[model samples]
Target: MKKYKYPSVLTIAGFDGSGGAGIQADIKTTSALGCFSTSVLTALPVQNTRGVRKIYPIPIEAVADQIRAILEDIVPDAIKIGMVHTPQLVETIVSTLSGYKKIPVVFDPVMVATSGHRLIEEETIKAITEKLFPIADVITPNMDEAAILADMKVVSLDDLYTAGKKIKQLGCKNILLKGGHQETPIITSLFYDEDGHYHSFESSKLNTNNTHGSGCTLSSAIAAYIAQGKTLYDAVSLGQQYIYQAIENGMDVQTGSGNGPLNHFFNPQKLIKNEMV
Candidate 1:
C-alpha cells in the first residue's frame, strides 16, 4: 500500500458564518490554493457582509486543547493566525507554536473589521506585541492596525515604511503593511523583511465592495504557498496576485446586503499530493 499526503495549513482564526471572512475565508483560500486546511476557532463573531455585531472569544484552555488536538497528530506545513481576541489567547498560541519553530507562521493582526468594528480586546495588543510577534514569520497589518502597532498615524507611503520598521523592531521577522485603506485608486502594500529591505506591491483598487474576506484570503494564500514550499518573497508576491484576482473576479457579485466576499474559487487548483515521507 502507498500512503500519500497533501500539504496542509492550519488556520487559527475566528468564525464567520457569513463565509466571507474569518475561518471560512481561511479554509476557502487554502483549499483554492491547493492545500489542505485544518482550523482552530479562536472566536465566534456574529457578523455578515453588512457588519459585525458581537464577538464571543473562546476560552484560553479550550483554544489550547483544540490546538494541541490537531497539532499533535496532523502537524501542518504552515500556520495562518487570525482574530486572536484576548491577551491570554495570544499567550496560549505563542507557547504552543513556539514548539513548532520550523513551520512558517503568517500572522494577520485582525484588529478591526471592514465595517468599522473593533475585534480584539485592548490588552491583547501588548501581549501580541511582546509574545506573539517573535514567533511569527510574517505579520500582515492593514493601515489602521499598523498605526496602532507603530503608535502613530499611518497616513502615507512613508508612514507605511516607518510603521513597518517599528513593527519589525518589536521582534517580528517580517512585516507586510497593507495600504488598502488609503484613498487612492492604486493600492500599495509594503513588505519589510528581517534584513531591513522593503519590497512594494501595487494593484489597482477595484471599485467594488465585494472584498469582505480579502485580508483572511491574502494571509492564508501566503501560508498555503509556503506550505507548498515557496520562498517567503515568492509566497508573499503570489498571495497578492491571487487576492487581487479574487477581488476582481468577485467585484460584481452580491453575497449579502453590504460588502460582499472575494471570489476565492475563481481559479481553484487541484489538491497537490506527495508520497508520505
Candidate 2:
C-alpha cells in the first residue's frame, strides 16, 4: 500500500454565493491546478453575476480559529488572500499568518468587484497597504485596485508602470498589475519585483462578458503553482496562461444574465488516491 500527499494551497477570502469569485473561485482554481485546497471565509456576500447586494463579515475570532486549526495540522504550501473588508480583519489575517513566513502568500487586493461594487472599507485599504503588503510574496491588483492602492488614475501603460513602481515602494516585494481594463485589443499585465526588474505579459483580450472571477482565479493559480515549487516568475507566467485559457474556453458559455465565471475546470485533473493492501 502507498499513500501520497498532494501539494496544498489555503485560500482566505470571502464566500460568494454566486460561486464565480472569492473562496469558490479560489478553490476551483487550486483544485484544477492539482493542488489540495483549503479555505477560510472572511465574508459572506449575497452576490450573483449581476452584482453584490450585501456582505456579512465573519467574526475575527472565527477567522483566526480556522487558520490556526489548518496550520496546526495541514500547513499549506502556499496561501492566497482576498477580500479583507475591514482593518480588524486585515490585522487578524496578518497576525494568524505571521508565524509562517516561509509560506508564499499571494494577496489579491480585492477592493472592488467586477460589477463595480466596492468590497473593502476605506480604512481597510489603508490597513492592507500597511500590514499585509509587506508580508505578501506577491500582490495581484487589477487596474481598479492598483489605482486605489497607488492613489492615481491608471488609464494608460505609462500610468501602470508608474503605479507599479509606486506600489513596490509601499513594501510589496512583487507586484502583478493587471491591465484588463485598458480599452485595447491586447491585455498587458505587468510584473515588477524587488530587484527593480519588470516583465510584461501580453495576451489577446478575449471578447467575453464571462469574466467575473478572473482575478480570483489568477491569484489562486499562482498560489497553486508556487505550492508545487515553481518560481515566482514561472508561477505568474503559468497562472496568466491558465486564466487566459479558462476565459477563452468559457467565452461562449452562459452562466448568468450578467458577467459569468470562467471555466475553471476547463482542463480538469484526475484525483490521486492511496491504495490499501
Candidate 3:
C-alpha cells in the first residue's frame, strides 16, 4: 500500500542562524500549522536578534539546484518565498519556479530586516516587483516594504490602501498589507483579492519586542493553511489568528538581548494523518 504523505510547504528564503527569522521561522510556522516543511536557502546571513552582520548569497546555480532537487521529488502543495538579496538570485528563483505556476505561492518581500538592516539591493527589489510579483498568488509586505515598493509612505490606513492598490498594479494577484508599523491601538492587516475586494483583519496590538520573525511566520502559516485546502480569505484570516496567539503567548518570554522571536510552538499539533491510512 502506498503511504500517504502530509500536506507540505516549500519555503525558499535566507538562513538566519539565530533561528528567529528566515528559513527557521518558515519551517517552524509551517510545522506548527500541521504541514511538512521544506526549504531552499537563498542566502546565509550572519544575523541575530541584534542585527545582520553580513550576507553571503548562495550561488545562483546552487540555489536553483536546491529548488530543483526538492520539486523533482517532494513537490510541495504550496510555496512561500522570502529574502532574495540580489537581482541574479531573484531572476534565478523566478525562472526556476515559473514552471510550477499551479502551485500557490505566498511571497514575503523581505527587503529589510526588523533591525533596520537592508537585506536586499535596489536592483533586486526591481527584479522581484517585475518578475516574482506577477506569479505569486499573494505578496505580504509590511508598511516599510510597501512604501519602498509603491514609492509612497504607508503610515496611515489610507496610505496602506493606496500602497496595496499600487502594488497590485505591479502585477500581483493579491496583496496582504501588514499594518504592524502603524502607530495605532489596533493592528490592521488588509487583504486585497484578485477581484479588487478588500478584507480587513484587525486585532488588538500586543505590546512586545519579540516580533523578530512575525512576518515570515505569518506568511508561512498562510501557505500551510492554503496547502490544507483553505480558501485564500480563510487562510489569511486563520493565519492572522495563529500569529496573534503566538505573539500573545510569547509576549513576556525573553529570548534575546534585542528583538526576540515568537513562540512558534505555542499551540503545537501532530502531523495531520492520512484518513485512509
Candidate 4:
C-alpha cells in the first residue's frame, strides 16, 4: 500500500477580508488548481471592490513567525509571495527563507498601483530590489512595476524586452512581464526564462471591471502548477489560460461596485494526489 498527499503551495500575502484578493484569492486559486494552500498574512488591507482604503501592517516578527511555522510543518512544494510592503519585512522574509533555499519561490511585485503610483517608500523598494529579487525563482511584474524595477518607461510591447533584460540584470532568475495593463484589445505577456529566451503569451482583453484579484490569482495558479511538477514555462502558460477563463467566465457577474474579482472556482479541480514514497 502507498500513502498519498496533495501538492501544496504556501502563499505569503496580505489579508483581503472581502475574499477577493490577497491570501483569500491565493487560497481560492490554489484550491481550484488542485493544490493545498497555506498562507502567511503580511498586511491587512481594508479594501473591497471599490479600492483599498487602509493597510494595517503585520509586525515584522509576527510575519516571520508565520513563515517559520509553515516552513516547519506541512512544507510546501512552492511559495508565492505578494505584498511585502516594508523594508524590515522584506529582510526578515529573505533571511528566514535563506535557510530553505531550494524551494521554488514565485514573487509578484505588488506595489505598483493600477494608476502607476509607486506605493511604498524608497527604502522598502531598495530592500526588495537588493534582497528579495535575488531569491525569487520568478518575479511577475506588470508594466508599471517593471518600469519601476527597470528604471525606464514600459509603454509599448517593444519595451518589454528591454525592461525585462534590465530587471533580469538585477539578479532574478526569471521575469514574466505582463502586458495586461495595456490599453490595447489584445494583451500579450512576455516570459523571459532564466536562459534568456523570451516566450510570448497573448489573450484578447475582455472588457470588465471584475479584474480585482487577477494578478494574485495568476501568480497563485503558476505556483500551484509548479507544485504539481509543471516546468517553469508550462506553469506560466497554464496560469495565463486559467486566468483568462476566470476573467471571461465572470466578466458579467456583479460582485461589487468598483472593481470586482475573477471567478476562481468557475471550474474547480479535484485535489491531486502524490505518492508518499
Candidate 5:
C-alpha cells in the first residue's frame, strides 16, 4: 500500500535571486505550512534585499509548458499567482488556469516592490483587470495596488472597503485589501466576501526591514489552508496570523544590507504526528 502524499500547491510567480521574495518565498512558506510546492518562474530578476536591478520575463510558451507539465502529473490542490510582467502573460495564465476551477486560486496583485519600483507594465495591468480578475477565487491587493485597481486614492479604511467593492465589480469573488500602507500602530487587513460582508484582521506592526515576502507569504498560506479544506475567511485569517508571526520572528535577522526575508521556519507544524507522542 502506498502512503498518502502531502497536498501540493503551485506558485506562478517571478524568481528572486535574492531568495527573499517571489518563487523562493512561496516555496518556503508552502513547505513550512506542510504542503508540497511546485513553482513556474515568470521573471528572472537581478535583485537583492535592497532593490530590483533588472527583470527578464520568460516566454509565454515556456510558462504554459511548465503549467502543463505540473498539472499533468500532480494536480495542485491550490494555486497562487503573482507578478506576470505583461498582458500577454496574464492572458496565458488565465487561459491555462480556467480549466482548474476545482482548485482555489489566490491572486496577489503585486504592483510595486517594497523599494518603490513598478513590477508590472501599465498594459499588463489592463490585461489582468480584463482577462484574469473575473476568474480568481480571491484577489489580494495592498492599499497601493487597491488604489490602482479602483482608479482612486485609498487613503483610509473606509476607502479600502470602497476600493474592494469596486474591485469586485472587475470580477473577483473575494478581495483581501491589505492596510500595510496606513502607517498605523496596528496593521489592519480587510476581507470582503461575495455576499457583501467584510472581515478584518489586525496585528501590531513590527518595526523591521525584513518584510520582503510578506504578501507572497500571506497569499500562499491562504492557498495552503484552502487546499487543506479551510474556508476562505479562515484561510485568510490564519494566513495573516502566520505572516505576522513570521515577520515578528525575523524582525531582527539582518539578511542583507537592505530589507530581509521573513522567518518561514520559525515554527512549523508537521502534518504527520509521531505515534509515540
Candidate 6:
C-alpha cells in the first residue's frame, strides 16, 4: 500500500453562520471534489436562510497577513475569491496576489445574498472592477451582480450579452454570467473568454428555494477542477453540471425557514492520504 498528499486549493471569502454560502460552500465543494481546501476569511456575516443581519469585514492588514501566511506554507494550485466587502480589502488582495504570479484565481463577484441583501459596499465596486478583475483568471457573476457591475438591468439574453461584454472589457480572462435569477424555465450561463469567444450553457431550471451558495460552489468547483489540471472551459463546464446536480438533489431537503443550502457533498470523492505502512 502507498499514500499520497493531495494538492490543495484555497478559498478567500466571507463566513456564513448558516453554512450555506461564502467560504463554507467553497470549502465544502473543494473537499467533495477530492482537493484539500484552505481558506482566508474576509468578512463575518451574521446571516441565516432568512437573510443577512449584519456584516463585519476583517481589517485589510489582517486579511493580507492571512493570505501571506497561507501562501508561505502552501502554494495552492488554484484559488477562489469571494465577498471582498470593501475597497481596501480588494486592494489588499490585488496587491498580494500580484506578488504571487503563478496561482490561478477564480473570482466570484459576490455582491448580494440569497435573500436579496447587498454584501459589498457601494464604494468598493470600482476597486473590484479596476483592480481585481484584471488579475482574476476567471470571474463568476450572477445576474444581479453582473447587472450591478455592468450598470444595467440584465433581464434577457440580449442584456446578458451586453453585460458579459462590459465585464470582459474590465480585463478578466473569462467572464461567466450566471442566469439563475432570471424568471425562466431554462437557465443559460454565458461565458466570454479573453480571445473574444462566447459560450452558452443551458440547463433545465429547478423550481426550489435551496439555491443558496450556488455561485460560490460553482466557482470553487471550477477552481478545484482547474487545480487538478482541467482546462478553463472544461473546468467550468463540469462545474456547472456539478452545481446543477447539487441543486437538483438538494431541492427536496428542508434546511431552513428560508432558502436552503446546496447539496455540496452530493458526490463525494475519497482522498488518498499520505502514510507509512
TM-score of each: 0.97, 0.96, 0.97, 0.96, 0.95, 0.95
Question: Tens-digit lDDT track for model 5 on 64-165?
Answer: 989888888888889999888798899888888765555778999988887777887888888998877777889999988998899999988889888888
Model 4 ranges with Cα > 4 A deviation: 114-118
Report how far residue 101 has shifted in candidate 4, in Å. Answer: 5.0
lDDT of 1 at 267: 95
Model 4 earns a TM-score of 0.96
- Kindly report which residue stretches of model 6 are placed more than 4 angstroms away from their true locations once superposed: 1-3, 272-277
Question: CA lDDT of 170 in candidate 2?
Answer: 92
Instruction: Give every collision pair in model 3.
Output: none
Candidate 5 whole-model C-alpha lDDT, 0 to 1: 0.86
Q: State the displacement of the C-alpha of residue 244, model 5, in Å, after optimal TM-score superposition.
A: 0.3
TM-score of candidate 2 on Cα atoms, chains taken together = 0.96
- Lowest summed lDDT across 10 adjacent residues in model 6 is found at 268-277
lDDT against the true structure, per candidate, is: 0.91, 0.91, 0.90, 0.89, 0.86, 0.90
Query: Model 1 Cα displacement at 217 (Å)?
Result: 0.7
Task: For model 2, give the 10-residue run with minimal summed lDDT.
Answer: 268-277
137-197 per-residue lDDT for model 6 (tens digits): 8999998999998899999878999999888877788998999887789879999987989
Displacement of residue 228 (Cα, Å) in model 3 is 0.5
Backbone clash pairs for candidate 4 read none
Off by over 4 Å in 5: 99-101, 271-277
Distance (Å) between predicted and true CA of 27, model 6? 0.7
Clashes of 2: 0
Q: What TM-score does structure 5 among the candidates reach?
A: 0.95
